[model samples]
Target: MKPVLWMKSSCTTCRNAKAKLAELGLEVEVRDYFKKPLEAGELEHLLPADPAPMLGTKSPKYKELGLKDRHLSKAEAISLMVQDNNLLKRPILVHPKGTVIGFDAEAYARLVR
Candidate 1:
């Protein structure tokens, strides 16, 4: 499968990630998650057993729920993220090799190389 970039179009970080991918000459299918959020089953398929890496700790809802101090099961985390797309980290590259959350210049470059 081709690499799919899951992100929120309104987010600056997501936009920068997209630009970085372009700069790397890596074409990907963009999924504006906010516009078309994924279902729990879909997220389960994409994410590993521990979905913590995919959680958006910086999101207001995460803070509102005090998730930082709380320990959540994989099911709980996916539930929250599915309920609020904002709860999911932006610019997740669902590549053939694996999934990557947030923008990492080196990791993104490695996808194509």
Candidate 2:
């Protein structure tokens, strides 16, 4: 099982989620969301399906940019994400079957176990 967790180095939530994963004795590969962010093509490769409306950040900047309010085409959204990695929701756990976004404890436990 490829347990790759994508995270912004500064996000406390991302740090906490990583610690939990480690506590479970799961050795996960880490992706630096800011330095080496995931691209749309990368999402398609790692995720089960193309994350269209699904890919986004709940961070203030993205919200300030009104990404959620966007009626963007798939390509448009992907382009924006490429330009700004913070556009991706943090601690996105890319598993073999699917993905976990935003560091949800209950959901992550279900998948990790």
Candidate 3:
């Protein structure tokens, strides 16, 4: 299967990831999570069970929503992310070998190459 890149169009990291994939001559399927939000199952598959990695702690929305103080379970976090794609960290690259969350140039190179 072709690697799938879950990303937002406006994110610089997402753009960089896409460019790097191209540079490596790897064909990828891009999924704009903003336009098409991820389902719960998809989120569960992409994210860690801990939910901390899936949650975008740095997002203003997280602060605005006052989620920092709240301890959300895996299900709650997954549900929240499904409702709001912005709650997720951008540029999740899914490959046959493994999945990489966020932008890691070295990881991308290792997986894509």
Which prediction has the highest TM-score against the true structure? Answer: 1
1-113 in candidate 1: lDDT tens per residue?
87899998999999999999999998899999789989998888877787778888899999999998887888998888888989888889988877788989889888888
Alpha carbon lDDT at 55, candidate 3:
76
Question: Where is model 3 more than 4 Å wrong at Cα?
Answer: none
Please identify model 1 stretches exceeding 4 Å from their true place.
none
Candidate 3 minimal-lDDT segment of 10 residues: 45-54
Model 2 whole-model lDDT (C-alpha atoms): 0.73
Give per-residue lDDT, candidate 1, residue 60.
Answer: 99
Q: Per-residue error at 92 for model 3, in Å?
A: 0.2
Q: What would you estimate as the lDDT of candidate 1?
A: 0.87
What tens digits encode model 3's per-residue C-alpha lDDT throughout 1-113? 98999999999989998998888887899999888889999887777777777678778878988998887888988888887888998888889988888888789789755
Between prediction 1 and prediction 3, the one with superior lDDT is: 1
Candidate 1: the clashing residue pairs are none
TM-score of each: 0.94, 0.79, 0.89
| Reference-based lDDT, each prediction | 0.87, 0.73, 0.86
Candidate 2's C-alpha runs over 4 A off are 46-57
Ranking by lDDT: 1, 3, 2
